[model samples]
Target: MGTTHDEAAGPRRRSLLQAAVGGSAAAAAAGATTLTGQAAAAPAGTAAAPRSGGRFDGESPRFALAVLPDTQYLFDADSADPDPLRATFRYLVAERADTNIAFMTHLGDVTEHGTEDEIELAADTFGELDGKVPYSVLAGNHDVSGSDDQRGDSAYLRAFGPDRYARMPTFGGASPDGYNSFHTLRAAGRDWLVLALDWRVSDNGLRWAQRVLDDHPTLPAVLTTHDLAWAEDDGEARLSDNGRRLWDGLIRGNDQIFLALGGHYWPPGRTVLTNDAGNDVHVHLTNYQDRYYGGAAMIRLYAFDLARGAVDVETFAPWFLTRDPERRTPLEAENVELTGPADRFGLEIDFAARFAGFSPVPAPEPRPASDVLVRGTVAYWRFDRAGLPGAADEGAPVADGRVVRDLSGHGNDLTARRLHTSGDGALTWSAEHHVGQPAHASLRFDGGQGPDRGALLSTRRDAPLNATRFTGGYTIETFLKLPEPFVGEHAWMGVLSWEGRSGDAGKTTGWSTEEPTCSLNVSPERFLQFVVYPHVQDADPTSWSHALPVGRWTHVALVNDGRRTVMYVDGSRIARNPTQRSTGIATLGKPFVIGGTQFAERYGQGFYGWIGDTRIVDRPLTPRQFLTPYR
Candidate 1:
């Protein structure tokens, strides 16, 4: 996945993540000022606690940790000011005993070049906090050499070696006398094993990490590396080579691995992936090396509220605090000089759900049609004929093997126009994917060159079900499993849509010139978006807050109550329209299409995944009803 942005720096930034990387008048002032003056400016002991502007409203964590992004900015040969980097470490030393900070973590790139001088400066700068706080320093591409291929030899270890860490009792171990290492910390009634992996860890490194994970199966693990997760030009999250390999070889299978942290990419990013055990592994990437003059002394303060199962991340510039007040953005400005959402945010991490001996519900039972009938369903499509387990019709076509049966009994059968065909001269039925309901079939769409373009259309040519009939209220719900790699992009990958025909060129939907009636689709970010015609009312397009987890079964429901429309994922309400529209759909008669959509023309770059039971409720479903499992 990639994130789209201008390659040219924004007005205040040299790169996307460099929004907070500018050198201000404060830097000059710090350079000219004496150490005694800097110390007095914020008085490290109480010196400007993490700006109380984060989501938690400044609520301090039970324990916190500071994440130091690349310090290459500190040693850049082109930069004259060294005060920012030193000030950063000095602030840490001052607050080490003040804040309940257990330790600090460095995401690598300790120096500009793997040169002896740079490494020495780094060691001396960081050494200030050597015994003051427990910390882990990872190796970045820059730390090794001028280029990734030209890895440096032993300069880093010579500067900060085992002897530097030997004083700490929690120091678990290191890689054959190298920077790759792990440390232990106790919090929330649990011991956390934090692993700092080098920039390009070798096969041995992976094995060593796995052994560490295996040895401490009872402890929650946090992984840190130089480069890992990042947002490409497309705005989708992607893993680097080392990152993917690490996940495949080490992180994925380990149930105790809870968080993966990284930097080195220009833009800060985040993505949550579930391991095979259905546990979420939070991956975060933050770096500001692209900022002007090697970026300001901004650092991330992660306050872990273990009891609340949340981590409130705050970005602060301790150096900027010592500058004249008028030179910087007021602390009240949400900008915090870091322009994007990734600079600060809160995440809910339910450790109990991941670590508390959880097990999958075996052979989940199916939800019966009676459940929908009682809820006044107007239309339903259960692709029962496809993928039927152990049945003669299993792996057969809709009419030949699977039956496109409607649960509502309104005679609206679906035609699997384009589906995955098997190489054995028969369509393959998946037996392992069925969830919540045993032996229930689900339609799979191949995001390839297939006839009908991987879409399922209503067999009924005169499908009377349109948004016009439900102006008062209605709901569309389905059980969906997103593709493993996520197949769609900037454009729409239709889950379901009803729109004006191409022949009706003059027809217009309030939101779009062609898309009318109603369409429910997933955005590139994977959030659900429900659209009603002419959804141009500034609030016409309402989307969910949570992105549907890929490769997992999830229930998505969209409800509109005449005025307000809301989206629900799983069984929780995620988002709702901020402004209610008084007018309903202007155009209606188009036939409903599944797996893809149609607006001006058939907008079917159809979704590639599985869709289980899809139902259209005649009335808006309550939150309780929306929470109903696909069973």
Candidate 2:
């Protein structure tokens, strides 16, 4: 297929992606150019055509929305360090400010660090974004770590806003910040519950959500959980498995959960999955991955015309504040009607007008028995700081230019040694932490070896580059022991990297192939990207990945089952993929680093933390496997 390639295509891809997700360039490329004001709903008589760039927003349309991750870091110090909000502040402004977006919602982890100053700083930073954009935030595992059980988050409320089973008003008003971490917004006519689950916290969080849904049984909803519910790794630890009870209690049994999926860090950023009823629900995850890739994970801006049920998605990839790219709409609503009948007469709500008077005009236009629907997503990231501990001195611990070898380590024994942090940062424990315990320490991996006293983080397996295996699904499970009542930074777990050669670059692919399936990272410091799973089709012909869990001796695994890829936490399946095939092949010349990646963009040039019982099994494991209690 030696077709003449288009170089400009890359730039164009960037341009299209930027606007699709509502980025700086996205606003500019979009026809209107003004992201602040609402897109004037065109005359109903006109062809309800979507805007040119496929992006639209309303200032006070039926509703407003936003997405923010890890606000707790605002005041929380790195144990004995104070970089003066240099990194955090830049990150805050990058996503919410420098780049333009419709709404900005905080992803939680908003300072359960327990220091008064840290708490205040967290409040101040959130407040900084209040007036700029409509703000909404959810609670992370860290948000409720201390004794108050998130009661101490009052400062968070004081600065940002509140939500917990709230309703959408058809008029003007601000978002209330209190009670819990979930809410709804009715943009045009349909209702969308901005349901944000409390990650790494109490199982009761799910029960609280169930009560909220029980109170409003009929509302259609979009469930947003911080942890990757459908993660495609191994060892079982995803919320979907560990928290299935919660899902059963709140979402699965209900019809309101129109869509479910949202986890940061990894590849295949955009994805869509239908529920049992086959509704065209959507989900999104991005890299803003703080570990391996040094830039923002990126996101796609979404605009919905509920009145018309017409959605225009665009990509937004600006300078530093990166937004992901627009994916081909994989699934659509059966009727593809944005507006339907919504009659307020006699207590009846017609869904017609809600779809922009979408009455099917019979034109013998390939009419099928029923309707068709496709699903997909948009995602990316933005890396702000780098002057931490093991940003530079870290590198993959495997042999250079080596192919696949036994990661289980040593003389083909299938058993591997755990990669421990080299006193690199707080990630290294003076002693050992038990399972299910709060973690006050973390390994900050950036692209530098600054004024920190941490040791170099690296692995022990370094095989030859040419002899290593390549092509196929591989599983690496990580065991962690997180603090109880899990919340904030203490929440640990994630995979490091599988570089081809070079530190974080692919030796074979980087040097020859077009698609370099190399360099990967998974970090917990940025709760927004508490997880990571990446994928790419036919890039030269390979794709690489890595994932992790912040705190807890839990197993985090990845599996490429032909097309149906799966991720698991503690043995329970968390995510699934339908594109990449499982060839049982992989490039392993690059040793798998721990505590971080081979190169720390935000994760690590090398790891700076602790890893134990690291197992790399060739076959995929199920959730029940994790429950069996390691022999």
- The TM-score leader among the candidates is 1
Give lDDT tens digits, candidate 2, residues 17-38.
1112324233332324334232
lDDT of each: 0.62, 0.35
- Residue 491 of model 2, lDDT score: 24
Candidate 1, residues 77-120, lDDT tens digits: the string is: 65535666666776666665445567788888877776788887
Instruction: State the displacement of the C-alpha of residue 348, model 2, in Å, after optimal TM-score superposition.
Output: 26
Relative to the true structure, candidate 1 has a C-alpha RMSD (angstroms) of 13.8
What is the alpha-carbon lDDT of model 1 when measured against the actual structure? 0.62
